[model samples]
Target: MTGWLGNRVITQIGILVHDIEQVSGAYAEFFGVDKPPIAETDSPDMAKTRYRGQETAARAKLAFFDMGPLQLELIQPDSEPSTWREYLDRHGEGPHHIAFVIEGMEEKVMLLEGRGFPLQQRGEYEGGRYAYMDTLKDLKVIIELLENDKR
Candidate 1:
C-alpha cells in the first residue's frame, strides 16, 4: 500500500468482448441487475490512442455496471489498431485487465516500466488518463492505470 501504487483503489475490471449488447445483457442477467449503460468512444477518445507508444485510431464500445465498490467495464474493440483490438485478435473475448484508480499516473507508469512492465497503450479522456501495462506475459493479465482528474 506504500509502494508505487500508493493507496489508490482498484476501481474497475475491464473485460474485452466481441459484442457489447449481447454480453452486456448476459452479464446483467447473471449479476441480477439492470442492464448497464453503454457508451461508444468518439474519435477524440482515440485521438491519442497508442499501441506500444505509437499512436493509432483504435476505437471501442464500452458498457459500465456499478458493482458495489468497483465498476465492471465491458469493452468491444473496433477495427482500429489498439490494445483492445490486439487482445481480441490474439486471444478473443475475455477478461482483459484490472484497473487501479491512481494518481501521478506518469510517475507510476515510469515506476512500473523500471520494474520491467512497459506501457502498452494510453489515452486521455475528459477527466482522466488511462494507460495499460504489458504485464500479460508475467502476470497472466494486463494492468490498467487510471488517473482521474483531480478537479
Candidate 2:
C-alpha cells in the first residue's frame, strides 16, 4: 500500500479476450453465475478516448462480473488503436490490467509517470474517467486508474 500510487487495494482485474461472448459464457459456467450482459464502450464523443497521446476512436465490448471485493472485466477491443487492442495483439488473450478506484486521477497519473510508467490510454465513461498506465516493464502488468465523479 505504501507504494508509488499510494493505494493498496485493487478493485478490478481486466482481461483481454478476442471473443467476448464465448469468454463471458465460459466465465459464467465456470463461476456458476448467470452470463453477464455484453456491452460496448461509449462513442468517441462520450468516451473521449486517447491512446499514446493522440485522440482515437477506440471502442471495446465489455462484460463485468462482480466478485466479492474485486470485479472481473472482459474486454474485446475493436480494430481501433487502444491499450486494450494493443495488448491483445501483442500478448494474446489474457490478463490486461489491475484497476484501482481512486481520487485525484490526474495527480496519480503524474505520480506514476514520474516513476517512469507513462500514460498509455485514457477515456471517459458514464460516471467517471479511466487512465491506463504502462507499467508492464516494471510490474509485469498495466495499471488502470478509475475515478468516479462524485454526486
Candidate 3:
C-alpha cells in the first residue's frame, strides 16, 4: 500500500531525551563536533505550541545537529503535556520522529489523516509549519511534516 506522505526525503530525525545538555554533549562527541546550539520555543515566531490539535502551554528544549543534508533534533519536553512528553511517558528517552519536508502541508495533513495517520501535535513558526503524525504503530516512529513558505 502507498503511504500518504508521498515521495519525499526524510530530512530530520527527532529524539526525545530527558536531558538536553547531556544528550547534546553525547551527540556532539559522537559527531566529532562541538556542542550544538540549543533553541527554545520562546521565539516570537514560535510563540505558541500545540498538543493534540489544541493550543497548549507546553514547551521543549531543543538542540539540533547538522549532518550534511539531514538534521538530528534532540527534544526535551519541559514539564508540560505535549507529544514529546507523551512519548517520554510511554517509551522513555529514544527515537521519536522522522521528518519530511513537503509543500501544501495542510492538504498533506488531510491526506495523511485519511490514511489513518492523525495529527498528534502541530505548531507554526514565522518561516514554516510543523506537524507530528501519530504513525508509531505503522512505522515505529512518529512522522513529522514540515513546510516552509517559499519567499
Candidate 4:
C-alpha cells in the first residue's frame, strides 16, 4: 500500500469532538501535552450541499498537534447537518478515523471503490484531496486517505 501510494503512510489519527476547546483541553491535561494551533476553513460547495434546499454557510474549526510521528486532528463543525456534525450526533465524541497519507489518492480511491469499498465522504483541502472509506465490514472502523500538503 505504501509503495502504491509512494512513501506516504499513516501520519495522523483524527478524533471528532463536539466541543473543540473542551476536548482539546482535556487531551492536553490528560497527556500533559501543549495545545496545538487551530485553523478555520469554509467551503462554498460544502455549505451549499449541507444546506441543500435551504440557505446557510459551512464553517469549521480544526486543530492539529504533532504527537511524535503521528498528528491528532480535532474538528468541530459550525455548520448544521454536516458530515462532522452528523458523526457527532450519531456517535458522540471519540476517535473517529485514522488517516493514511498517500500519493495518487484518486487512483487509490478508485481501486478501493472497485474492490467494494465505497467512499463515505470525499473533499479537497489545501491543495490535497481526502477520501473516507467505510471499513465497518472488516474493521468496524473508518479509513481516511489524505494527500500530502502543508495543510
| CA lDDT of every candidate | 0.87, 0.95, 0.86, 0.72
Give the C-alpha miss distance for residue 135 in model 1, angstroms. Answer: 1.0
Question: Candidate 3, 117: how far from true, in Å?
Answer: 0.8
lDDT, candidate 3, at 39: 86
Q: Model 1 compared with the native: what TM-score?
A: 0.93
lDDT winner among the candidates? 2
Q: What's the distance in Å from true for residue 113, model 4? A: 0.9
Greater lDDT among 2 and 4 belongs to 2
Q: List TM-scores for all candidates, in order.
A: 0.93, 0.97, 0.92, 0.78
Which TM-score value belongs to model 3? 0.92
Residue 82 local lDDT, model 3:
88
For candidate 3, write residues 1-151 as lDDT tens digits: 3256664688999999999999999989988999988888764346566788677878788999989999999999887788998889989998999999887888998988988989898887768888999988888889999888899
lDDT of 4 by residue, 1-151 (tens): 5554465567788788878888888888887988766777547564233232334355678888788999888988774655566677888887778888777877887787787767776666756767777665875667888886664
Candidate of highest TM-score: 2
**Better lDDT candidate (1, 4):** 1
Q: Return the lDDT, model 4, position 34.
A: 82
Better of 1 and 2 by lDDT: 2
lDDT, residue 80, candidate 4 = 61
**Positional deviation of residue 131's Cα in model 3 after best superposition, in angstroms:** 0.5
